[model samples]
Target: MNWMEDGMTSIPNVLLQNYKRLQIEEKEMMVLLHIYSFTQKGISFPSFEDLAERMTISSSDCAACVKKMIQKQVVAIEQGDQTGYEFYSLKPLWNKIAALFESDARGQSLQQAMTAEKDLYSLFEEEFGRPLSAIECETLALWIDQDEHDPSVIKAALREAVMSMKLNFRYIDRILFEWKKQGIKTVDQAREQGRKFRKPTGTEQVTRSENAVPFYNWLEQ
Candidate 1:
């Protein structure tokens, strides 16, 4: 065999990537990896003395690390075919790493949603030129949590209201309701609908008089 082939040992990428999430110290991880290497070389249950020989730690410390792993359920002992034999299994470790990664992904998604909700509230307050009342806040929450409206779509509706010179909650609410009725779920869809809604009728120019606001009547639609 080539020298490179003789010396090469491969471990799962997830083991390395998510080892920190395992909540184990670095030394424990080193010990775990060394055990994994031993298993790859066909040694399922290397003696603690043998492990200590490969590392700078004492045999008792190696045993202690293995014990901790066993307590954490990341490693287990299984009986060998021979009555007096046993070995370490790393199955739980891989399972734990995968679960941690999955949980982290969910946590990140939920955090992004929460941040977007806060931003939506702040945007509304800024546009309305005052802090929102409790009922207004609840209405926004209902649109997101109950009606399942996307924050971006709601923000687009707010912009549409501003452009139409109808910067009020009732008009914005009507706009959202109309968009939902039309099955518009995205900001792009809402924009397209807005363009069509504002298309010039015959030779009439789209403009507002001093006492009249030119706006799409979403309430009637």
Candidate 2:
């Protein structure tokens, strides 16, 4: 059944959330609802005559209401198409909705960013085997964000330090400095470079390794 036959149409409540404050009169509101109904039914070119014929409004009144809607920027019309008016812009509606919700959207985005930063802090603590000091946290952030180093590369450097039994920030810094000198900017490159610098595995090799000395052992020496 045609919607016009039953005089039934549904309007989205959100579109009319500010309907009472729209600065349009009662008859104009009725015309706007008619436009909504026609648009929902896929009738791009709605007939003002048919609308006026069904309602108590005259065709002239309905036309005047459409002009008012266009002036208010609530509706738009394109002139060139043979369909009389082919384009109807809902930009005004979009502007209103964005104004209503932009703050909430930004708040959500800020919260997500803060959560991610905290997560990175926790990850660094776990990897470093202790709570990060303020300066240490800043250095980690600098590597990831300012220096544009990948977090995985930083983690690989951390793991490299741990494996060498020199789990110190200064040791990690040395690894980063060496990789930077070797043009390594990613975990894959770091791994390949690690392989290039790896020593032979044996008791004799361990005895010959410079990395066999811990940080505290060097201080005591």
Alpha-carbon local distance difference test for all models: 0.86, 0.73
Clashing pairs in 2: none
lDDT of 1 by residue, 1-221 (tens): 68877676787888877777787778888889889989988898999998899999999999999999889888999887777688988989988987897899999999999999999999999999999999999999999999899998888888888877898889989999999999999987887897788766643553333335555543222
| lDDT digits (tens) for residues 23-62 of candidate 2 | 7678887887777777666775687896797689899989
lDDT of 1 at 113: 93
lDDT of residue 60 for candidate 1 = 98
Model 1 TM-score, all chains together: 0.76
TM-score of each: 0.76, 0.49
The true-versus-predicted C-alpha distance at residue 63 of model 2, in Å, is 9.8
Worst 10 residues of 2 by lDDT: 212-221
Per TM-score, the best of the predicted structures is 1
Candidate 2: where is the Cα deviation over 4 Å?
Answer: 1-43, 47-76, 81-86, 90-117, 180-183, 199-221
Give me the candidate number with maximum lDDT: 1
